[model samples]
Target: MEYELIDNTQAKQYEYHIEGVLAKIEYIKTKDKIYLTHTEVPKQLEGKGIASSLVHSVLEDIEKKDLTLIPMCPFVAAYIKRHPDWKKLVLKGINIS
Candidate 1:
């Protein structure tokens, strides 16, 4: 499967897509952090790891841009918890807050 990130400025959100299936992600930007609020991968796309892939891609972007992440989305939080090495990319205080 192929994934792409689209910034939906009109909706004030970012979206991940695998073909035509869209995964909605809510984000809030602070001076030094990007907080991922919520994520939803359609039921038809469940169990296929699309959400994981989307989270990975978003994290990659964060790293490349030298931005810290506040993973408010449960899926993203769990993903960071699983990858301790990536914990370095998380913004301080925001993790617990």
Candidate 2:
């Protein structure tokens, strides 16, 4: 499912708000690559699949824009590991193991 992702570029995060809660994936972008630096989901929202959805949508957006990803955040790296197809979206030197 494609969720609404607000790329708050000024803040350098992609935010998803639902049920009065905010989930975000923070990143750094340089030239053709985006380094996913962190991911946050409110404590109350844990175990509810919010993070997975957020990561999925963010990856989709990154792929659509044809930008390479550097999954600096452990969560994002793990997500890529679980979903191997997305690994192709990652930057060449990254090992999402």
Candidate 3:
């Protein structure tokens, strides 16, 4: 799927758009950690794996910038659990449960 991923810094979110629907992963950044706050896919675009892809790309960008992750969103937390390699990007001393 060739989805267009956009880092909408003004909105503090990463958005992936396909056709007219959008999937977004919201975040808040601090000096060293990016707190992922929410993940949402339009109801019309549900069950297409868009949420997973959005978070995957978002995490990749965070890794490239060498910032830690604070998975405040349940979806993002579960994503890190599935992709153990991303666990290293999570900030220390944060309870992910």
Candidate 4:
């Protein structure tokens, strides 16, 4: 399946889609940080690693723009926790709380 990033400014979020289905993430940007706030994948889209792919794409965008991340979304937090190497991309002194 192919995925595309949609900047849904009206909704204040970035949406990732797979074959027109909202497969993974909804994020917002503020200053130099990208806040991953919500994520949802259809039950059928689960277990196929769509979420991971979406996260990777978002991270790539972050890196390209030299922006940091605030993982407000649980899935993003868990992904970061599981992959400590990516922690450097997180904004310093920024608390999700």
Candidate 5:
């Protein structure tokens, strides 16, 4: 299965659409930080790893832009915890174990 992650800058969200359901990670940006605010996936789409894919793609884009992250969204924070390599992307000021 192919998953395409699209950055909808106007909406300030990274979106993934599959089988007519939309999964997205919402963010708010400052000069140097992108605060990941929320994530939502349809009930039918849960457990398919779509949210993980969305977060990963969004983090990759932020890394490429050289912006740090404030993972305000619980889902995003948990994902980063599970995948420690992604921890490097978090903003230094916000302490996370």
Candidate 6:
């Protein structure tokens, strides 16, 4: 499944609304980097692969904007681990362990 990742800059998060619920990845943006700090998907929507999609969208957006990523959220970190190609989008000099 695919969804548009809404970069709600005013909310400091990327949002996706599906089935009338909001799924979001919160971020903190600096001049050259964005710290993906948390991910939230309602319990009713778990186990549906939505979180991975959200993370992918956020990573793609960060890459398009040329901003480094700091995956502070454990969920985002695990997603990156599973999708290693996206590691190139991470901020340099930071260990995501």
Estimate, for each residue in 31-85, the C-alpha lDDT of model 5 and write its tens digit: 9889999999999999987888888888889999999899999999999988889
lDDT of each: 0.80, 0.91, 0.87, 0.76, 0.89, 0.90
Candidate 4, residue 55: lDDT:
80
Show the colliding residue pairs in model 6.
none
lDDT of 2 at 7: 96
lDDT of 6 by residue, 1-97 (tens): 8897899999999999999999999989999989999999999999999998998888888899999888999999999888889989887776666
- Candidate 3 per-residue lDDT, tens place, 6-43, comes to 98999999998787777898889888889899999998
- Model 3, position 59, has a per-residue lDDT of 88
User: What C-alpha RMSD separates each model from the true structure?
Assistant: 2.2, 1.2, 1.3, 2.7, 1.2, 0.9
Mind giving the per-residue lDDT tens digits that candidate 4 earns over 4-63? 866676776656766556765777777887888888888877898888777877777788
Question: Mind giving the per-residue lDDT tens digits that candidate 2 earns over 1-97?
Answer: 4468999999999999878888999999998999999999999989988899999999989999999998999999998899999999987877777
* Reference-based TM-score of each model: 0.83, 0.94, 0.91, 0.78, 0.91, 0.94
Off by over 4 Å in 3: 95-97
**RMSD, model 3, all Cα superposed?**
1.3
Candidate 2 residue runs with Cα over 4 Å from true position: none
* Candidate 3 global CA lDDT score: 0.87
Give every collision pair in model 5: none
Q: Which candidate is the best by lDDT?
A: 2
Residue 82's lDDT in candidate 3: 85
Model 1, residue 78: distance off in Å is: 0.3
